[model samples]
Target: MNAIQFGEPVSGKTVSARVSPAGGLDILSRNEVARLRDASGSGLHQLLRRCALAVLTSGNLSDEPGTIFEQYPDFDIQVLQEDRGIKIELKNAPEQAFVDGRIIRGINELLVAVVRDIVYISTQLESGGFDLDETVGITHAVFEILRNSRILRPQVDPNLVVCWGGHSISRDEYEYTKRVGYQLGLRGMDICTGCGPGAMKGPMKGATIAHAKQRRKGNRYIGITEPGIIAAESPNPIVNNLVIMPDIEKRLEAFVRLGHGIIVFPGGVGTAEEILYMLGLLLLPQNQEIPFPLIFTGPQQSAAYFEQIDRFLRLCLGDEVSRHYRIIIDDPAAVAHAMVSGIDKVRNHRLDNKDAFFFNWALDIPLPFQQPFRPTHEAMASLALHRDRPRHELAADLRRAFSGIVAGNVKEDGVRAIAEHGPFVIDGEADVMRALDDLLKAFVAQHRMKLPGGTAYEPCYVVRT
Candidate 1:
C-alpha cells in the first residue's frame, strides 16, 4: 500500500528549514525554552526528544521504544524562542513526517501536543504544585493533566466509546473491529483507543468512512497513550487528537473518566488487564448502581476466544462477573445497537444522579488502582493475587499481574526487566494460579501474545500454586 502523505504546499525538495509553532504553542518564556534545549543530566530535554521522536515516526508499527533512539542516536529537538513565537528545530528528524520539506498538518498538531503535555507536566513537577499523595490529590492531578490537554469538553452528552484491544491481532479480527466502529459511527458515537495498529486502528478507520457518509462535522478520533507503549505501537494516522498521559495507570484512568462506554475486541494480556480494571471498579458497592455499557465482541471465529474469557471470569471473579459485560458475536449491528441502547441508560443514570456528562466523577477508584505500579521483579512477585481477599481487591491484584505481563511483552522498561532477570514469579492461591496458567497458555497457543507473523512469544511469567 502506498503511504498516505499530506502536504501544505512547499518547494520541490523536502524542506530542511526550522519552523515555529503554528497556533496553540507559541511565546514560551526564555527559561522554558532553555529547559527544553537542555540535554544535560538535569534537563527535561530528554523527555521532549523521546516524545517528539515518537510523534515524527508515527506510521512506524514496531512497539519498541528503544529502536527509535538506536536508529536516531543523535536525534535532538530544541525549542527556539523568537520575537513572535517559539520555533522547533529538528536534528535527524524522520523524513516521513514532512512533505516537500514541510511537516504534515496533523503530525504538526500531534508534535505540538507532545511539547504541550511534556512541558506542562514538567512545570507542574518543578513548581511542586502537583500532589502525588492521597486519593483526592492523585485524581486532581489526573483531571488537571487532562484539562490542560483540552480533552475535557463540557456540555456534551456522553458519546465517547473507548476501544481496548491488542496491537497484535488477526486480520479477520481487525476487519471485524472496523465493522463495529462503522456501526457505532453511524449512530453518532465517536471513538477513543490506545492508538496502535490492529484492533486499535481498525475502529477509527471504520468510523471515518461512516462519519463521511453521514456528513458529520467535528467528528472526534481521540487517541490516548503513554510514552512507554507509544514507540512500539506508534499512533496510527487516523487519530486526529492525541494525548500522552504520564503512565499506564493515568492512561487507564483517562479512559474510564472520559469515555461513556467501552467496546473490547480480541486481545491478549493487555485486553485482560483492561477488563479486570473495569470489573474491579464496577464491583465496588458504591458503583454498583451506576450504569456503564461494556461489550466483548468479535467475528464468529472468535466465539471460543470469548468462551475462554467468560470461563476465566466465572472461575476467578464468580458467576456475577457476567452481569457487567455482554458477549455479542458476529453481529456488528447488534453490538452497535447494544451500545446505543446501553449508553442511553448511562445518560439517564448520569442525569438522574446529576453527574457531569463529560467525566465520570462519581466512580470510586481505590488508591491502589490509581497509583502507578512499576513492574519490577520484586513488585511483580509481591502482588497479592489470592482469593481470600475481597473480590474487588483480588481483581485489582489480578489486573496488576496481567499488567506486568503486558509490560514484559511490549513496554520498554518491562521488556528490559524481563531480559535482566527471569520470568516474573507469581505465587497465589492454588485455584487462582491454575486458572492464570491456563489462560496464559491459551494466549500463547493462539498466538495472541505477539505481533502477527513476527517473533514468537515466550511467556515472561511463572505461575505458582
Candidate 2:
C-alpha cells in the first residue's frame, strides 16, 4: 500500500495520497462511494472536502474557515472503492499531516473519522435511518451516531467528564483548566472536550501526565465537534477519538448524553450558550431529580467572570437556577473532589433509575433543546428573551441568543452573515437585555470572543434593551 505520492506544492508543500482506512470505515457500498466522489451541486463531496481538509490541517491556530479555504483552495479529496475495500485519495493536502511521505497515523485515524461520520450522517441520518422530528427520536439518532462511531462502551462506568470552555482564553485560565484536568485524571476520570486549543486542549494535556502516573490504560480523550466549527477549531493532537455531529445542537446533546458530568471553564458567549443549554434542561420538572453535576471554575482572576455569569443567571432564570451548578473558584483539587463526589451521585442516580452507564438515556431533553437552532438574522431577531415565558422556555431562548452570538463570532456562515447583514439585532425585556449586554461587554473586554492573538473583534450583534 504505497499510498504517498508527491504532488505540486500549493503553498510550499502539497502531497497526494491514497490511504487505506485505519479500522472503522474499511468497507463501503458502490452507491456510498459514488456519492462521496460526486463533486456536483448536489452531493456530499463538498462537505467531505471541507471536513477532510480541516482534519488534515489539524492544530492550525486560525479559526477563520475562510482563511483555511483560501490557503488550500485547490485541495480536494475522493473516496475510492477498490475491489478489496475502501481508500481515501487526497490531492494537494497539507504537508504537516505527513512525516517523510506517510500520513501521520493519528491524523489518518481522524481523517477516517471525518469520512465515516460525514458518510453516515449524509446517507443515513438524512434518510429514514433516524427520525429528526421528535425529541426522543432525535436523541436516539444522536445515540446511534455515537454508537456507529464506536465511542460508546457498554462496560465502562460513568467517568467521562465533558469540559466546556472557549478555545480562546487567557494563559492563566488555560493553566488552571489543566490543573483541574490533572486532578480529574488522578482519580481515573477521562476527559472530553470541544477538541481545539486553549481550554479545550489544556485538560487533556494535563490528564496525560496524571494518567501516566496512575498507569491508567485506554484513557479516552475524546473530542466532539461539528462540520461548521471544525475548520475554525481544528482537532487538537491529544484527541484520540473524534466524532463530528451534524450541528451545534446535536454536538451539545452528545456531550450531555455521553458524559457523566460537565465542568465549565472561563469562556465567552459560546461557553455561556452551553451553560444555558444544560441549565435549561435541568430546570425542567422531569429533569430536576436527575443527578447531573455541573461546575463553573477558573483561577482567581476568573472569579469576576463567573460572578457576572452567576449574576446574569440569577437575573434571568431567577435564584432557583443557581442550584443547578456550583461555582468553585481557584481550587483545582476541590473542584476535582467535588466532581468525584458528584459523579458517584450520578452513578447512583443512573442505577436507581435503571439507565445505561455509557449514555444518559433517562434524562428528558425537551424538543426545543433537541432541535437545531439556525442562527439566521431573522431567527436571532425573532428570539423571545422576555421574562413573561416559563423559566425553562426563557432559558432556552437565552441559550439561543448566545448561540447566535457564538455563530456570529466564529462560525463561517455567521461571520459571512454579519459581514453582509451588518450584525444581528437582539431585542428583549429591558432588564434581561441589560444583564446580557453587561455579560457580553465583559467577554469582549477580556478578549474572550476571538483567539488571543487574532484580529480585534467587532460586535456581531446589537443589543436593544
Candidate 1 C-alpha lDDT tens digits along 251-311:
9998998899999998899999999999999989989998889999998888988999999
lDDT of each: 0.84, 0.88
Model 2: lDDT of residue 40: 90
* Residues 1-465 of candidate 2: C-alpha lDDT, one tens digit per residue: 011111122242688888887878878888888888888987889889888888887767676667778888889998888888888889989888888889999899999999899889888855788889998889988999999999999977889999999887877888898999999999999999998877888899899999999998999999999988888888888888999999999999999999999999988888999999999999999988899999999999889999999999999999999999999999999999999999999999888878899999988898999889999999999999988899999999999999999888878889989999899999999999999999898888888887655567789999997
Strongest candidate by TM-score: 2
The residue pairs in collision within model 1 are: 14-101, 15-101, 62-232, 63-232, 64-232
* Reference-based TM-score, model 2: 0.96
lDDT of model number 1: 0.84
Clashes of each: 5, 1
